[model samples]
Target: MKKVLMAIVVISILITAPLIYNRAKIEWNNDTYEMIVPYEEIRELAIRGLDTDTIVKTLYDNGVRGISFEPTGIQDLVKQGLVMTLTKSDLFSMLQKEDENTRESILYSRENGLYVLLRNDLDDRWENAIVKSFGDRIDKVTDLPIFKGESIYFIKGISKEELTRGMGAVANPILTRPIGFDENLMTEFASYGFEPVFRIGNNINENNEYVLDQMKQLQDKLGGHKIIFTGNTMLGVAPHKDLKTEDAEQYALRLVNEGFVLMPIEFTKQDGLNIYAKQFNNKIVRLHSLDFFDGRGGYTDRATRAVKERNIRGLYVHVADIKKLEEETITAEQSFEVATQELEAITSQMADKHQPGIAQSYDLLQASKWMTIAGLVGVAAFIGLAALMVSEKIALLTFAGMLLVAAGYIVTGATMFLQAASLVVSIVAATWAAISGEYINSKKDMVFKFLKGAFLALIGVWFVMSLLYGNQFLVKIEEFRGVKLLFILPIVLTFLHVIRDHVKDLAMTVVRNYYLVIVAVIAAGLMILVVRSGNDAGEMVSGTELVLRQKLEDFLFVRPRTKEFLIGYPLLVLGMYIIYQGKGWEQRIGKYLLAGGAIGFLSTVNTFTHLHIPIYLSLLRTVYGFVFGALLGLVLIFLYRLAKKYWPMIQERL
Candidate 1:
């Protein structure tokens, strides 16, 4: 039975080798990223008497690769004094010596309705967009022959208070409705060799057909479909109902088919983004931005780390505060100089690994059904082998049950089941390795035991990685669940296993020792471990520790986890030495120490569960952890020997 299980593991590994290779190739090819700044920021500089062409050229020379452009709206036109809005009463008061026909036509419209007057300088696209957006609620007042050459329309079912004072009125209502992309502005940027990142707005009330048509026209004009959607929802998505399930799927399909890649901002909430990205086959880049007005420092370091460590491809930079520039407290030249220096610092830090260019979606490998099934079978085999360490009966029962579960999951194709099974396999593997080292007598024996445990834990890593393989996992649309459990469960299981044969003796020993003190210390340690498990655990990290982490990252390129190399691995070795070689009180405490060593195995497996990190980087981090941990463990053993040799003389003097 054991031979059969081993064979299944080997075959599964062979079957999934292609997936590993494809993932590596995709990550290797995606080595370029883009630095994008809002077009409005550049326009603000232009408004301050800085030449637009010179600003663009200067930014381009300093690692700026793209300019993000949001479409102009009626509110913007009003603010710029290119369009005028008036109530019917206001318009009636403005007109003097009008023809009777024009007067009669004006009287026919709603008395309280709002009228919009478009100047000749405005683009005709605005008129078309307004018509499409409002449909029957808006009417062209062409009956007035006296105002024939002027563009004027009356909007119905809207009050002045609703237009001016309603919540989000300026951003989401009819007045602030986006017309379309500014083609001339886009053309200017393209002429200066900037990739235009279209920032899609969701303020307009339009049907799906018109929304898709507008997107198609923009794509035709810009020649690319790199979209960064603004607001809480996506284009064509309704505000009240959100996007209907079918509509979202249809829109996602159309966009993907048209080669539109969405760049969702990291750490921000956007409705339906995950579903849309999943439908796009997860072929999207992640964008990172820090608010320049927040007054926090270290923007360059964070941006560089985003590119180097988190697979972030788009760095959305906020170069200058628009309000600050408008207030004249800061000059355009000063803002430009500051932005240039920051860009240079970021680019210089990342020059060794990435180059500034247009960010593209990764062409990742799609997992085949057979490969997924094989991965599950391998995980079941690993679980069975770990169970075999206890007894043949338990091993056989576990193998059969896990195989049946894998078969059922294959039939049902449930993702949650796969994640749960992977988590169980990881816990089992870590626990089994933690207790595998027994009768350790020499340094050679200790090293061999550690390597054996590491090898078994690595097998668990492979199984977890293969079972959860997909583009969704790669981009973090789907994550490996139960991370806190992954950190805690293995240690708990190891504790139970180490004490199973001596529970009565352990109870007595604990009562005789400083029972409350030990419990308090263990509880505190567990709390810290739990607090420091996830991606958002940066808040819990101390400033000194963060500096140390940065220094390690700079020196190693891929920093080894502190838990694995510094604390967990060394304690594991010390525990093994004391339990096997020491006499008296050391033997009693050694069991707990050995159980605590499970953290090392747990951390080794945990490293691979971060699916968004590149496989090569994870592998490098694991190697560094093991080498440094082993050396640290040996140093700990030397300290133990030195203390043992001098303890008797010191105690006699006392």
Candidate 2:
């Protein structure tokens, strides 16, 4: 049975090795990234007296490669004097004395509502867009006399207050409905050698065909293919009908077929974005954008780290200090200077690894269905082998049950089931490795024990990578669930395994004051570990630690996690040395240390779970951690030996 399991494992590895290599090749080739600035922000700078041409030229020279353009809406049209709105009272007052019949007809049609009037110079497309965006809420009223030679369009279900407030509101669902793209703005930026990055806004009552048609037309006009959706949903999302799932899939299919690459923003919640991007088949780039107000000061450092560390290819640079500009604290030129300096700082540091250009989607090689089945079999066999160390009966039962589950997953292809199974595999493998260490009689024995644990953990890592590898995971549209659990489970399991035969002794030790204090300290450390285990760790990490991390990344190219190298692995090695000493206190303390050492195995597995990171970088980081941790363990062993040699004499002299 063991031989059969071993053969299954070997075959699975052979099948998955090629898939891993292909993923690595795709990631390595996706090195180019774009430094994009919003066109509205640039237009704001131009409004403040800076020349538009000069600002574009300066930004381009400093590695800004793309200009993001959001579709124009009624609010923008009002601001540009292309459209006007008035209350019924205001409209009646504007009517000439000779236009009594028109006024009487308007009063008969509607008693109260805001009326929208387009400029006479504008074309019919503008009216068509307003009708399409607002639908039945907007009514064309030729019965009323033309105002300033433009036709009257009466708006329903909107009060004057709502219209005024909604117009100035950011990302308002109704007021920010797409009217059309500003073709002249797109042409201006494209003339200055900037790739256009389009932002799509959701309209709850949107005409799906019109929205899709507009997107296709804009793509044709600008000759740029990248798109990012704005607001809380995608272009066709309808919350009233609850059509997000259906809308997302349909829009995704249309967008992909249209040859438009989706760019999902990092750290932002957009409903249906995950479903939408999944349809692109690895033809998407992850984007990182900073808030215009919140990111004013440290934009450069944050953006630099994003591109260098996170595989973020689209750097959405929001350099304008909108708050200061609104407060009149700085001149527009000063803001422009700050923007240029920020861009230069970020681009200069990243020039060696990345070039400024439009980021292209990765054409990743697809793993075959047979390879996935083989991987699942390998994971089951490996888990069974680990169980064999504890009990043959348990091993056989676990293998059969796991095979049954894998078969069900293959038939159904349920993502939740796959994620749960992968988490269980990770916990079991890490816990098994953590308990595999025995009495370490010599330095070579200690080293071998540590290496063996790491190897076991790595096998778990491989199993997980094969199971969850896909474009969705690669761009973080889907992530490994239960990360905090993955960090905590092995520690708990290892502790239970170590204390299984010592419950009475543990209860006695628990009552001791020093032991209670030590337990409290360990609990505190575990709490910190749980808090710092996710993508949002930056919020909890300290400034001093962040600076240290930056220095390490600079020096090592890929920084090893501090917990793995500095604390977990070294403590594990020291624990084994204590177990070898064969003293009463050593036996009692060594068990606790061994349980703590399980953290190293869990951490090793967690490193590979960050699917967005390149595989080669994770491997480099693990190797660095191993080497550094072994050296630290040797130092701890030397200190133990020196204390043992001199402690008795020193105690007698005292």
The 0-to-1 C-alpha lDDT of every candidate, in the order given, reads: 0.79, 0.79
- List, residue by residue over 517-611, the lDDT tens digit for candidate 2: 97799899999999888755644778798889879887887789888888888878888888877477676567668777888788888888888
lDDT of 1 at 549: 91
In the predicted model 1, the residue pairs found to clash are none
- Please report the candidate that would top TM-score against the real structure: 1
- Give, for candidate 1, the lowest lDDT window spanning 10 residues: 203-212
Q: What is the C-alpha RMSD of each candidate to the true structure, in Å?
A: 3.0, 3.0
lDDT of 1 by residue, 524-602 (tens): 9988988888755654778898889989888888789888899788888888888778765676566677677788888
Q: Cα deviation in Å at residue 58, candidate 1? A: 2.2
Candidate 2 runs further than 4 Å off = 93-112, 131-150, 157-159, 162-175, 204-211, 240-245, 292-297, 322-324, 501-510, 537-539, 582-584, 649-654
